[model samples]
Each structure stands twice: as C-alpha cells, then as structure tokens.
Target chain A: MKFVGVTSCPTGIAHTYMAAESLEQAAKDAGHEMIVETQGSAGSDPIPQSVIDAADAVVFAHDLPVKDAARFAGKPTIDVGVKRAISDGPGLIAQAAAAAADFKANPAKAAAAAAAAPTGGLATKVDSSASLGTQVRQWLMTGVSYMIPFVAAGGILIALGFMLATFALGKDGPVLITAYDINLPKDVAHSIMDSFNPLSLTWWAALLFRVGVAAFGFLVPALSGFIAYAIADRPGLVPGFVGGAIASTTGAGFLGGLVTGILAGLVARWISRWKVAKGVRGIMPVVVTPLLSTLIVGGLFIVVLGRPIKALMDALTNGLNGLGGGSLVILGLILGAMMGFDLGGPVNKVAYTFATTGLATVGLATDAVQYKIMAAVMAAGMVAPLALALATQLRPKLFTEPEQENGKAAWLLGASFISEGAIPFAASDPARIIPASLVGSSITGALCMAFGATSPAPHGGIWVSLLFGNIFGFLIALIVGVVVMAAIVIALKSRDHSLAAANA
Target chain B: MSLISESQVILDLDYPDRHQATRALAETLVADGRCTDLDLFLSDVRKREEQMATGLPGGIGIPHARSGGITTPSLVFGRSRNGIDWGAEDGPATLIFLIAAPDGGGDAHLAILAKLARKLMRKDFRQSLSDAATAAEVVEIVEREVVNA
Candidate 1:
C-alpha cells in the first residue's frame, strides 16, 4: 500500500511538522510506503503529483482547511486533527491502509467510506464555546496581515521620495522641512530650465511622493474590506470598503476604520444568517447581500456615525497634542503595551497605524509631538524580539534547540525592528510570554516618551537612531527595555519549569 | 552503499549508560566501514548530544550527525533491553538509532533522517522491534520501515 499525507495547524510552527513526523512513522510501521508534506508558517514542500497519483490513500491532519484540497477529490482519504496524527499516528495509518484496500477491491465503496469517515473531513465544525475575544482577534489578524504589504511599500517609497527631494536641493538651500515643501521655489519652477525638462530630479521626486501617497490612501479600505471578508466572506467586502471610505473622508482616521470594519462585518454576518429560499440564496450572495449591506453600512457611516466619529477623532488628536509630560508618558506606555500585546497581531497593527497616520499628516520632520510618538512606537516594538533573544542567551536550558536557533536570528530581526521574530516564543507559551512582553514594552514606551526623544522616519528601529532628536535618550530607552523584557521572560520561564517539575 | 547492514545491528545490548551506548554504536559504524574515524565520530556525536537531548517520546533516542568522520550515510540501530538515559523528560530509551552522514551529504542526510524519524513515531514499530525474536527479524523490520518502505 502507498499513502500521502499533509499536516497543518493554525500557527503553522511546531504542531504541523511534529504531526508530519508522526504520520511518516505510522505509514512505515503499517508496512505501507508513504510521502508526507508539511504546510507550515515557513510555507510548504508540496508532494510531487506522481506520488499523489500513485498513492492508494491520503491523510489530512489539519486545524485550518488544507490549501488546494481539490487535488484529492476522488481519492479515498482520512482527515483528523493534527494532535491525533501525533498521538495516534499508527492507528490512523492502519485505518487509511484498510480504506485503501477496500477501495481497490471495490471502487464503488470510496464515496460511502469517505462520507462516513468524520465530520471535519472537508468543512470542519467550529467550536461554539470559543470565547468572543479569541474570535475577534483572529478576524483582526486576518485584516492586518493583508494590510501590511501596503504599509511597507508605501511608507518606504515615501521615505525614499523625501530623501531624493532633499538631495536635489543645492548645498545653500535650507533643509526641506515638509513633503509639501519639496516643490521647487516659484522662480526656479517657472524658469525655462524647469519647464522644458519634465524629468527633472525634483519632478521625479514629487511623482514618487504622489504615487506613495496614493498607495497609502488604500490602507484603510483594505483593512476594512478584509476584516469584513473574514467575518462574512464576499458579501461583506463592498459595505466594508464603502464604510471605510466614509470614515477616511470624515477624518475618523484608523480608529474610525476599526469601528466601521467591525460594524460592517457584523452587519454582513447577520444578513448571511437570514433564512432565505434556495433560489434566493443563490442570487443573495451575488446581488442581494452586497447591495443591502452596502446601503445599510454606507448610509449609517455617512449620516449617523460620521459626525460623532469625527468629533471623537478631533478630541483624540487635541488630547494627544495637549498631553503634559506625565500624561504623555502614560499615553506612550499604553501604545507600547498594545504593540507587544500580540506581537505583530491586530493590537500591534493598531499602534503602528496610529503612528504612521500621524507621520503622514502631522509633518513628521517638523512636529515634535508626532515624531515622539513614532519614536515610542518603534522603541516599544523592538523590545519584544530583543528581549526574547537576550532571555534565550541568559538561560539556554529554558528553551528548545529550535528556539535557541531562532534567538540567533532574532538579534538582527529585533535590531531591524521586526516584532514578528518573537512570535514563535509567544505562540509556544502565550500565558507567560505575552505578560512579560507587555510589561517590558510598556516600560520602554513610557521611558522613551519621558525622555522627549523624536524620530523623523517611520521605521528602521535602532539603526534609525541618527534620525532621532535625542539619540542618547533613544538608546537608553531601548537598552532599558531590552534588559527589563529579558529579565521578566527569564523569570517567567524558570517558574514554569519548576511548576512542571513539581507536577511531575 | 546501503545506509545500514546486518553487521551493524546490536540486538539486546547491555549498556550501563548513554555514553557507553553511544560509544558502542560508534565502534560498530567504524567496523562496518560506514564511519572514517572512531574518535572523530564519537566526539561529533558527543557534541551533538550536548547541544540538545535526542530522547523522544515512545522510548526512542535518535542521536544524529552529519560529520567529517562519516564515510557514507549510515544508521546504527541498538536495542538496549535494560534501557539507558537518553535525557528524555519522560524516561530512558529502550531503542537508539545512531544516524551518521558525510559532511557534504547536504539534504540527503536530512532526507534519510526524516524518513527514519517518522517511522520511529509509530508505537507498533517500536513494540515490534522490542519483541523481535532474533537479530534477523529486527533487521527485517528496520529494512521494511526505515530503509525500503
């Protein structure tokens, strides 16, 4: 007998590969030849089509729906949880082998056997008991993942645009204070030297700046559209995008984007649950759901929600600007806690977008308040991974071999300002790791703000310290944060090990 | 050459500890022409053990390396009837698979190790190995599951 298997999990880290190992062992023990594929966070090594075609049966041990499931349409298969593949691998292989034999003996039995296999075979059942907070977080993460490319591409282009614009100015010119200030002075711009030459360095720089601004314009709608798609699939998209456009038009910013996205998603979801006839249901997804949801969400945003949200947004901007030293530190602390709370998750995205939006509108190079927020956000973001790398080095015995290897990479990732480097540790032991990250990051954010540090650039972590108004203060904040985070994480891990030993 | 041979199989070996077990396996690999130098292989294995404990669930220890001392890819299977400490949090290992490969073997070594590691995940495979009546039956099981199958 021959079989093929795929193992996948939600986080796509440890569980996926662990299950693959188990499945391979079980097939060999059952005296059946097999090839196993792992679909993990690092991506997949897809099995060859020839192997799939030759296989008698297939096994799918997954938490999320397997990608490209249609490839195994007619095959006799078994699907189970990833955990089952790890603990009961032999038994699962035996079951698959038996099914394979039955199909060979009688091909007609394939469909019936597949139907009788289990409930989670193709479309898995949802756990109704899962908390609301957990569900919201998952949906928010889906939106944020889709929104990141826009941020990276747009923000980097805008930074490059400004850098080039500054270079075009003669040494006698004063530093370009703002993006808008990049337009050549009236006399030069009207001169025949500038008019006859459309591809001047200043013109090219302005073009780059405008294109980057256009891409940034899509950020809110993308976030809103995807958030709704996560909730109600295709039907939610139009309403979510329209609602988000209204939010941006009304000056509600990122906070308004969040409200409209969740509202649009819930509304679309509620509409999807309606008990319509089969004929109507077919057309509902195509026409009815989108039209009605868009009308409702768009109308609500424009009429009822727009002014109130705008007022709230205005109050928020004023509050941030008016904050005294103590209150500014507190605000920084809050933003920092949010950034590390989930490590590149929805919470982190919220803090990031908050800072980036401020950079976009508040004249980052000139506005001290705006640049200080950016400094605090980047410093807090860098702390999680840097602290984790430090913790692994301080107590290597506390971590697994893979984690220690990850630590070596985290050093560069953290320095370059990538918080996602710490995600593996957080995913492994969320209860302990998250709290430690939060406590340390909050302290870092508070200290950075208190030091009155500022940054012109939106990204680049510790390497961008030269851009900071107070480089010494920025370094002090980062070092203090790294030390605190490392200390907390090490302490937590030690306690966990002792408790495990005691239990044993 | 094949990764494993009948001569390298150690059925019901009585090793007092993990160090002795590792040393006994290294000697067999050298004798079978699978390893170039006994001392180098032993040191490489010891260095790997220090990096991480190889003891897995199901009473198995897979001490593996891709070292300069290896002449060819090889697997040395040892059945320790009394069990020896493999640094597993669960308990000692009754089955030890000493995996070695040439330093330049690259993905080939990982491919073979992955194949063997997957099979060791099965309780039935471990149970059959433990209850094998003779060294020949043990070799048959390893050949079918770890090498050919």
Candidate 2:
C-alpha cells in the first residue's frame, strides 16, 4: 500500500519532523511506500497531488489543522496528534493499512462518510486535544460561517427594498406601502397578478421589500440548524431547525436561536449514540433520533426556556437603545479590536455575528444602534486590508514578494470589505502587524460610532453605500483608519535595526 | 562551519533542570564563538520552548532558537546522567540537543536540523548516541548521520 501524510506540531520544529521520519520508517518496515510532508515554522515541502492521488491511505499526525485537507477527501484516513505518531508509529501505520483494506471491502460505507463529511473549503479539525472553549468556538464558527451568505443576501435585498420604497414615495413610502398587503388583491395591480407592470417603481419597490422580508424570516432557523449540523451532522438538522423556528416565533432573537441550536444538537447526538438492537439501530437516525430530540428540545424551549430568553432579548434591545455617547464608543472599540485581532478568525466572526444578528430587530430604521454597529464593524474591517495595501504601496521593499502581490489584489478586496485580504501579511509577521491593526481598527470603530454613520446593509462595504446614512462620515472613518494603520506598520517595521535584508 | 564539533559535545552534562541544561549547552556554543551573546540565545530558546515544550516522547529534548545572537548555525549535544524534566508526557529526557541558528542571511542550520530531526527518530541512531564512549565519537556519529545524510 502507498501512504501519504502530513505532520505538524505547535512549535513546528522537532516533533513534526520526527513524526514524519517515524511514520516513514514504520511504513518501510511494513513494505509499504510512504510520503510524508513536514509542516514546520521553516515552512513545508508539500507532497505532490499525484502522490496523494496514488496513495491508498493517509496519516495526518498534526496538532494543527492539515492545510488543504479537502484534497484527500475520499481516502482511508488515520488522524491523530504528532505525539501519537512518534510513540506508536507502527500502530498508526497498521491502522492506515487496515483502513485501506476496509475501504476496499466496503467502498459504499466510505462513500457515505465522504458525502456526509463537512470537507468543504471550510474544513476545520475539531482536535480532541483542544480545550473545551476552543472546541465550542469551532462548532459555533461552523454555524456562523454557513449563516453569513444568508445574512448578506437578505440584508442587501432589504436595503435595496427600503431604498426603492423611499425613492418611490419620497418620504412616506415605506410606512404607507407596508400597511397595504402587496400580495392581496386591491384593484388592477400586482394584486391583480397578470396586470403587474414592470415599469411601476412603487409596485416593484413593494415587491422587493416583501421578498426581502421573506428571506429575513429564514435567518434565525438557518443559524440554529447549521449550528446543530456542526455538532451531529445530518441527524441534528431537523431538531435544530425546529428549535430555531420556535425561537423566531417566540421573538427570542439570536440568543434563543443559539440556545436551541446547542440543545437540539446535544440531545440528538446523545440519542443517536444510545445502545439499541440491530433493527432499532437502522431506524435510529431516520425515525427515533430526530423525533425524540425535537420533542425534548421543542417542549423545553416553549414551556421552560422561551420566556426567560425573550425577556433577555428585550433587556438587550433596551440596553442597546439606551446606549449613547461614551458607551457606544467603547463597544465600537472592543468590536473593532476583535475584528482586527485574528483577521477573520473566530474573534472576527464573533464581532461580525454580533452586528449581523442585531440586524433582525433593526427593521428598516437606519438610525438604530444596530445600524451604527453594523457601520462600525464594516468600517473597522475595511481598514486592515486597505492599510496593508497602502503600506505595501508606500514601501514595497518592506514586504515580501507574495505580500506585495497580495497587496495589489487587496485594493479591490479592501474596497469590497474582505478583511481576510490582510491575512497573508499578518501571518508572516504577526507581532508587528496585529498590534498596528488593533490600534487602527479601534480608532476607526470609535470614530464611526461618534460620527453616527448608520448602515442598513449587513454587508457589501463601500459598494452598498446607497443603503448607508451619513456616507461622508463612513468615508472619513475608513480613510483615517487606513492611513493610521499603514503609518503604524511602517513605523514598526522601520524600528527594527536589521532592515537591509528585507526577508528577515 | 560544521553543525556539531568536539567542543560542542558534553558527555556528562549535569544540571538541576532543563533550563540549566539549556544554559549549559548554550554556554558551549558561546565558547565555540558560534553564539555571540549567551543571554540573548538562551532567552530566545526559552521563548521558543514557552510556545510549546521541545520534548519528544523518547528520552530526547531538542531546544532550539533562531536568534540575532547566533553568528553561525551550531548544534550542541548533551548527555545527562540524571535525567532533566523536559515536560514530555512520557518521562525525563537524558539526551538533549541545543540548536542555535543565525537570525538572517540563510537557513543552512534549519536544513541540518531537518536532517538531525529525522535521524533522531530511529532507534539505532539513538542507541548509537547512548553507546558512544567519548565526545569525539558522538560528534562523528552526528556528522555521519546528520551532516552527511
């Protein structure tokens, strides 16, 4: 058998390379050909795609997520920590060989696992060795990750709807138009179905607004359902969605959705793992698990948890409504710092989710605190990438070849509000880049809050400026952040005495 | 220019803890003139160790650093009669390799480390190190297995 693998440890110096050697030696003794990639601080010499394609089995011994793991999707895999490979190399190799044989014996089972596995580009290793907090973050991130596109679509559509309605009715458009059931029959109009006029701005505006509302309706359920999916795969989906829908109906908002997601996922997972007869086992996931879990979770939410959660949501809403002057600036500072901290990591996602989830309650009032938060987050997010790009442009010699190239692409990415465009620059020199980012973003966040820039759209950055109120304030905040961050980065890099080498 | 030499090998390196053992190994590199500043290199090694313990499951600890204090790519071999706790889950490490690489210019020592790293995992390679009678013999083994690999 041919085996291909990757080995990485936290420090990425000693254990990573040793694990690769040990695995290689063990495979050789078993008369199997093996290729191992060692991902160390010095960097990795990645195994060829052809070698991975030819391999019957794979061994991933890493404390970190295997970079580009989806490449080996359908292969028989043995995943463990680097220490395990070093200690029991022979055992892991034997397991890999066994897994390969198992695949050949039952190809159908392997296919089923592959089909159900979340091996998309968002693949993250929920390392059993990681702390409970880390594990929970990974799970929550999976749900938030899937929930993003929904928010983007719904938020933008709604913003456009509001925009068109305002344009059509001048100022009284939304209030008057919303009172009438756009779907209901009234004389000869969209209510008349076949009499729909494409050129009628008022009619089109009302239609877009209603469709946007329909999309917003799915927001909470999707968040809860996907969170549950992260925990227990497909079996958790039914209860998760049920729990989310109940939360939405109860007016419990995102807090309720979060609770229901975890509850449903846990209950479903527990039920699926119960010891049962062979016949019972076959019906377990399909009939028993979802049924029992949904009953348990749904009852708890309605009778026990729903009221307290709704009250909490009310208190939160009131608190945000009362937030003024100083408190708002502090909140913006914290959220902005979090956004820049990890560059689209869990911290950034948490900040993003905080802003987007609040969008559910803001309802078309662009002056609401939720709208201001959305504005602040988007402004802060745009700063890092644009700053990195500006820094690279200002001093191209300070950055590496790859970073300079990334900077060129960052102009468009930053304009589009993709914070991840700065990740490459941060990854190479975190100590210098991260602090500069935090400082810049915090200032940007504070200034945006102070300026009272309100964003109607949850996303689209500068492109969705039509949905933003106080457009000049937003532009000023964004510009100030970019310049400050770029200046700080340059100052920090220039401080280092060994500036000649460039690579170092 | 060699990674490990006679001056860098200590047959009976006695120390209270891994910190002292690391300091002792780093002192040898300083004496060899491979490391320019003992404090800087030692601090760098400690910083790297703090990120993650450098202990391997077998009775081996490799403490390393890429520091401005290092003038050359150097390796020091230390054998402790009484093992020092290197924070491995299994047990204490008797064999310690302190690797110091230059801060800039190139990564010649990292290449040496990559080779030494692989060889250290083999049982025969480890057995040979423990069986070596003198510092010169141990240096010869490292040169053959790692430097010449």
Top candidate on TM-score is: 2
- The TM-scores of all predictions, comma-separated, are 0.58, 0.67
Candidate 2 chain A least-lDDT 10 residues = A119-128
Q: After superposition, how far is residue A307 of candidate 2 from its true place, in Å?
A: 1.3
Q: For this target, which candidate reaches the highest lDDT against the unseen true structure?
A: 2
Give the CAPRI rating of model 1. incorrect
* Candidate 1 DockQ vs. native: 0.08
| Per-prediction DockQ | 0.08, 0.30
Candidate 1 residue B68 C-alpha distance from true site, Å: 59
Least well predicted 10-residue stretch by lDDT in candidate 1 chain A: A120-129
